[model samples]
Target: MTMPTSLCPYRMQVHHIKQETPDVWTLSLFCHDAWPYEAGQHALVSIRNSADTLRAYTISSTPGVSPFITLTVRRINGGAGSQWLTREVKRGDYLWLSAPQGDFTCAAHPAGRYLLLAAGCGVTPIMSMRRWLAKYSPMTDVEVIYCTRSPQDVIFADEWRAFPVTLFAEEGAAQGFIPGRITREHLACIPHLKDRTVMACGPAPWMEFVEEQVKSLGVTRFWKEKFFTPSAAPATSGLKISTLQPVREFYAPVGATLLEAMESNKVAVNAACRAGVCGCCKTKVASGDYTVSSTATLTEQEIADGYVLACSCHPKSDLVLA
Candidate 1:
């Protein structure tokens, strides 16, 4: 069997489906052969409906714990990818998945103690780390704060009972869950917060707020796996975006993401997360001036080499991309 690469997707059959909540499901997909990935990585899952639509979903199953990959999907009302995966996909159905990608794992960024902050479905990656730590480094101090809309909406409710994890809900009367949202007080309440490395995931805005609160509490090491924040519609500044290897050009607006314009113009490129988090869309800018929302998974050398996340990058001047 061949191993999957970042750009080459592999087919995996849905082996099992367990409903975690009314709107959320845990899907176990057969790897056939072991899939190589770290706990905090995500895969680009492609589903076929009217046409093929792909979306990034964090792999919730820890590699050392399960031979198969599991994706916990929350059914979004109008989200095509989530809706299809949660409602349409069935056992035995095969889904195309990109290789596990991202660097938001303890293996990549280790700490003596850790603070995990997850909101809603963002719990996927964060909890996967907890599972990984339990298997590989049980003595490591780990604190968890998971926020949900309500207690009933919490995914992985059964498994959490065995661990020391705090659950917060905006509403819903639950015996153990804290009422209302995660506040600065809750973050400050973590003992020796200064020494823990914080890993958080959720909507981009929510992450920013959590990061702010985390920093305010004297914590310096903060890691986040990002969710895409869609840019506002562009007003057509007519900037030229040129790509090589067949060498094509397209016109885009100032605020338009490079990935969006490329796809619209039929210029092929590998991309996932459409957010800066995945780094799947990182490309070398032979010549260009642009602004990127975040350099989440990139290294200093890659940045110096002019590598930019096409998903978050907005061209400022006429651009030539490799």
Candidate 2:
């Protein structure tokens, strides 16, 4: 296995896809040349429909293999990316891609003992890390603590279960399976787990809980990858709200936030985070248009409902929203 020396973010075609679990599937991609990325970094997947809408997916390949990438998509109810990857994307299908980008990687620390914790399908990114570590740093101590609803829900079950893994299943019977969440009490079962460099990826609350618990034990080296829709802006502090009169147009400057654009032009709207993370800044897109930096997991129903995250939205054309 060879580590990628450069960030190769090239468009790739889906060469093969396999259903590994009921809810999870693996996608193998091939490019004209090898695409390279640090383990845990994600690439933006641009899925062009006939109407030309786009979506993004995280890269799940190990950096050790520069040209090939593999991803495990866990089907989520009504999730656009998850559904598309599982039901629509087939071998020989094509998708455009942005260069590999993201800070969630293991390149910063190579020699430390890694405590990788993943819950649900959040295992995708960490799996990349594990794949690389297994090949490049086999001597490094690595322990993966995975929590899933059941054995059936465990993404990459065979691979991880075959490694130095601690399987924590919330339900169903599996020998040595720890029932319940990855709480402080459960972590105690793993001797010396607190002393390792923890890398956690999961739902926001799960990551937060792990960070809090790990910090409580005086372990400070903790890395977390939190997934959340962009949040709404706070009501107080540098925020002004105004409603648009019926049948009026508004203009906002370039780089102005949807909230800022609305507020600057006296268009009343809600906001949060200003960055794409929390889902609080959502609003209906009534008879107008705006540009969103990233979709940030806006539901298909929400897109139909005209809901846009105001904090990360920028006006491209004059639009009306309430």
Candidate 3:
């Protein structure tokens, strides 16, 4: 499907905001001209801050629901964006948003059975896909294996239990639930994993671990969706950053984010959502090597093209940004 224009016309108003966890809040938005987003797609939501700075978030709600989109935000200590969202944002507040955008989605495969693996808030996008399938492709059998630290950390606990689901809690469960992380043994317990197409979304380590475990099972069509980028270090000196030139090079700090480092060097990169979820600030790497943060938004082709999100990427070594 074609994406919406750069300047989104839809205006969203916060209908309700509720605390789901000690650090996470569910913000529901009411929008005009219902936004068009496919399953697993994310919208770039921007909220006005005290100094008029805009903070961006990803739309967690499925687009099938008219006029409403939900966003789940996890509070990060010492984060200006998190602090503003939790402390200053109020119900009925209006916010600006870009058209929904994201490439992490379920490809049309005629596979009869499927596996959905998710961790923490990573469940948001996968939930969208699940809802879509439930809406349009009811016969597509699905099995959800969700992992979290404990029952309290489960984001969509009640809703998931109502479906064909397996819950894995690390801290321990009261029975009918698996304890600890998703290990190879847990995967082995699932029937027909080899015949099913698996879609995984979570932290990088989680994705890597599951991908590795499932590889030996002869599952060739495993797809991964994550919000975290791979780790990267600062860029070296004597480099330039811009979109005009097809060839570019720059320096980035180990701890300093790619956006922060690039902006510090006066590079013009668009980053509506500083968080890794939004794909803005994504650029082609062209050549050289680098790493991503907790959230990764690179496609297989983009990865081949050396593309990277300047917002979440840090330079692991001196590299070029095209």
Who wins the TM-score comparison? 1
- The reply for model 1, stretches above 4 Å from the true place, is 1-8, 49-52, 229-271, 275-289, 293-310, 314-322
| lDDT values, one for every candidate | 0.82, 0.67, 0.68
lDDT, residue 24, candidate 1:
89
Candidate 3: tens digits of C-alpha lDDT, residues 32-129: 66566777766554444222334455566765642468877777665555666777889987666676665666644445788889987788777777
Q: Which residue pairs in model 1 clash with each other?
A: none
Q: How would you encode candidate 1's per-residue C-alpha lDDT over 1-322 as one tens digit per residue?
A: 2323444367788998999988889999986655799998888876562223467889999987876789998887666678788888999988878778788899998988999999988999987999999999999999999999998998899889877999898998488989998899888989989999999998766898999998988999999987553332333458998788778777876556788777556566666567676666778899978988888888999999999888888888999987
**Candidate 2 structure, TM-score to reference:** 0.68
Q: How high is each candidate's TM-score?
A: 0.76, 0.68, 0.72
Q: Model 2: which ten-residue window has the lowest total lDDT?
A: 1-10
Between candidates 1 and 3, the TM-score winner: 1
Between the candidate structures 2 and 3, which one is better when assessed by lDDT? 3
After superposing candidate 2 on the true structure, give the runs of residues whose Cα lies further than 4 Å from its correct spot. 1-9, 49-53, 65-67, 228-322
Question: TM-score of predicted model 1?
Answer: 0.76
Residues 185-226 of candidate 2 have per-residue lDDT tens digits of 766555667678888888756887888887787666898765
